[model samples]
Target: MTPPDLSVYRLVFRLGDALIRSGASSATTTKALLAVCTRAGLKHPSVSVTLGQLMVSDQPDDGSPPRTRFHEIEPGALDIRWRTRAEEITEHYLLGDVGLEEALEEIEDQVNQKPSHQWWKLVVGYGVLGTGFGLILGGQPLTAIGGALTSMVISFIFRILGHLGAPGIFGYAAGGFVAVLAATALNTAFSLDQVAVCIVAAIAARLAGIASYGAVQDAITGWYISATGRMMEVATSTAGLVAGVAAGIGAVRLLWGPSVQLIETVEADTTHWTASILGAMFVAAGFTLASGGWAVRLLALTGLGGATELVYLFLLEVGTTPFLSITVSTAITGAACVLISRPINLSSNAIMMVSLMPLFPGMLIYQGLLGSLFGLEDSGATLLEALITAFCLSVGGVLGQYLFSEGLWLARRRQFHHTHPGESFSKVMPEEYNSRDIMLPVFSKPFNGSEARPAGRTPKGRPTADA
Candidate 1:
């Protein structure tokens, strides 16, 4: 009985930890680590991935004790840059371009890399994002300017709170509070008719659309635990936002009187297709710029955003319900993101995030929260409608992603099983593993270097094929 080499286990754990921190789902994490193990010559490695933890274990061919390692993942900011780099390292490792030690070093470097862009870009991006949504929500030029200013303030607050290690709820609540307070003051001072639109736009970036989409995608991939965790996140953030809006409204009401109106919902001006399309583009560009994305990807996503908004407007003009219209547009945008991600050199999540920004129901949620607070007769109905809309958006994105990506994943897993017989679903990392194929080798042989290489080593450099 010999001691098993722990380097392979460590590598799997490291990669999985990076992906999880980058918000990869449990299924994805499992599939990715398993693929790495399988390619590295491990016979049957086991992987378990949750939102905040990753575990990897593998049996040695020499019949030594099975080696296992676990890592606790601290989720970080949603940065497509880091996520893409991590995946590329995995791909390079699988291609035999780097040995186990080199792969580990690369992962470490990626983890410690500084952000590509400075902080002020994010503030500007948020301003543009708010202005775009303001126009989309039927606000005039003044409202757009007001919303942009408010968004810059919210963005600053968000960064400061994040740096200070404040709770997410506090950031969301603070943003909501500021948005409402600013809009109320502006409306009162200038008699603005679109104050509600401005407030909604200012807080649009804080919505839980990404989390909602992740929750549905995790559930679809059979990662129920991860799905539940994401759902809880969505609920908490949204509740915090609603509470903040309520507090803001209360403070404003106290300052003025009960008769002092704050938020005034206006009918969406769909006839301004030009403004709507441009608004969507601005939203997309703003998100990309703020996230430190590249210029080429920003332009591509901006185009995608405008195209999606066009589809939404066309659907509305043709008499589809607003909910249905957004759902369709979001699905189309998701599919487009998947298709174009490779060409644009952007992760699908990055493209999807920007492409679907125009469709988030921030306005609906704010309006519903305001109504509920004031005890409007239709408040319950508006809130229900908002919930349904969020659900529909999630479903649409999940379905779109599944159509292009996950369905093919199942096919490949089945193909691998048929070819190899009894490999246990080819050890796919779902919602997490950077997928290329289940059992396919990225190169003719594994990289040979230090003793840290994967198992099944013989005199030759080639790894023995899986049984």
Candidate 2:
């Protein structure tokens, strides 16, 4: 067999780096990289992915030496635009619509694509994001507005720190610290209730919801090394945020003494349904704009966020526990995104990551941290509850993906069997291939639930019985 040229390794490295930096999971990155290699005619290529780096290696079949390359992924915010373009190029390359050289150029173009929106627009989006979260967390109108201003300030701090090359954890810590100080000052001057609500909402973007979900999903998929790395990220990020908020609170207590009054905010009641829905949409839209995505894409995320919250609020009113309600809502949202993202030309991961922000435990984490700091007896329980909620969010997302992928596999198999009549299932899909393997190429195919080519179909459009 003729061996693939060295460009194959470069292709894998570039693609994997983009995906990882764009917040794709290690397993997903590895899968996409391998698919690229296979399509490029590289046999038995090995790809390894971690939180910060990727490694790819392959040997030539005609008695040539093996070549290995490694790439360090740069830290980047979640940008649906980048991921969407990458996926589109991959799909086109896989479908033979583009050659190797063209795909390589496309990858470089995406990596170098300038942000369409101005930096100030992103700051404005952050403000909107915080306001939405404040409303969702039951803050009053004034408090929600305070959250918006606080979040805008925090976004400024983050950008400045990034420009100065500070560590990411420190960025979170600084944002948290600023959030508390600003919220407290606003609350004191205006008598806005629910100070903590404002603070949490302002710093909601700092919460590790995506990392937590990725960690659990990686662990479930047996990528222990990547899972451990992601878990560590979640731990450090949350710890920094909690520590910053704690310090701000301590400083306030020391300065104001008895004059500083802090009160706990309760969850949103059913009467606040309008505010909650609006808040969710705000968060979704704000996230998209903040991430430098196209304004048109906000429609999908906003709709998804609003619908998910509507369902969640309804479930809560029906007497479901917060844990059960959030899990079910996240799962349903995940499945819905998977089903709809392809048709709309959006990234499912992007929608899932942003739409579920309202359900994240940012406020809970802050409340628990405050409780522990004040030496409240229920502090530990509150923190534990937050932990459980984060875990449930992860589980729900992973479960939703599996349910959708597997259900589609079954439906496709049944359709093929009905049409073929005499062919065995093993002819196309073997026992070794599971739903995950089929779904890993998500960037390459659409999940429209229609009659389409089987996942394992041959290049010539003929059904292949082999594994």
Candidate 3:
């Protein structure tokens, strides 16, 4: 095997880096990188994805010093435009239609792609997100209106922070703190019954899904370092959010007459199914706007949101616990993403990720943290339950992917290699190859639903199967 041209190596590096910074999971990014290189007919191209950097190299079979290239990556900010364009560039290259200059131009275009909607439009979308969450949780009219107001405040803070180019951690923390402060004030001013739902909704659009699906995939594939880094990023962002909310609530109590009650907002079984589905749609559309995704994708995600929430409701009706209900709900969503995304030219990463917005434990984090601080009854238990719920989500996502998509991914790789000799598989492709890879003897083919490989991985990050 000969070394790839230095320009091709550089293009590959840029492509992988763009995917990472655009919030593609380690597995998806890695797989996409390998696919592009293989299609480009590069020999023994090597790529390593770390927390803050991406490295790609071309190694000759002769064993001389390999030429390598790298890029420093800021933590990802979800922009579906980047991922979509990257996929196009890769597929175009694979079809043998793109030249080096075209690939470079594509990368440049992606890096500079602006949001599909205006800034003010995003603010309104976030407001809709808060309103949706409030309705889903059965908030009263006052609570729903207050939630929208609070979301606007949070959006304003984020915009200012973004304009100033502030550090991500501080910006997130500030948004959380301000959102709580706004909600509490609104609750007092309106003489509302409970502010918990309002506050949760205000920040619903901001809760970052744990890239745990990516962590699961990385750990499964023996990339422990990258896995740890990915998990830590999620933890740190969540901590910032918790601290900000805690501080904001504490400050309000100190300055005001009384402490804000840490009410556990619970909806009765009679909470309307239609309301849940509609609210889920609102949340999904809001997320797409806030994150700079295209309008067409939003239509699909909105429908998916409704369908998945119905699944969650069905599980609850069948007497499922909260943890189990969430797991099953996520599993259904994961399966839908796997079956639906490819034909539509959508990135599964974005769809599975935003689908989690309706189910994430945003309010629970605030209630648990404040409850413990105030020495409220069962506060400690609430906190413990919150942690358990999070663990369940991560586990569910991993299981969903394994059950739905991993086998198909493996089978596809096997078949591709069998048909086209001398092409290296993605790094996610296991080292050991057997007849199962070529024929999928162990699992069903894509969209077949014939084989049950037990519960699987992937909720958001790589849909648990890359998991």
The TM-scores of all predictions, comma-separated, are 0.83, 0.87, 0.82
lDDT of each: 0.69, 0.71, 0.66
> Looking at candidate 1, what is the lDDT of residue 461?
41
- The worst-scoring run of ten residues by lDDT in candidate 2 lies at 443-452
- Selected candidate, larger lDDT, 1 vs 3: 1
**Which digits, one per residue and each the tens of the lDDT, describe model 1 over residues 193-307?**
6667778888876774455665676777667787887777767777787788888878978886666556655445689999988888888888877776766777887888899
Error of 3 at 14 (Å): 3.0
Tell how far residue 431 is off in model 2, in angstroms.
16
For model 3, the superposed segments whose C-alpha errors exceed 4 Å read 1-6, 38-42, 60-63, 116-118, 262-270, 406-467
Cα TM-score of candidate 2: 0.87
Candidate 2, residues 239-308, lDDT tens digits: the string is 7888788788788778766466553634554568999999988988888788766656777788888898
Q: What is the lDDT of residue 125 in candidate 3?
A: 79
- TM-score, cand. 1: 0.83
Question: Which is superior by TM-score, 2 or 3?
Answer: 2
| Top-TM-score candidate index | 2
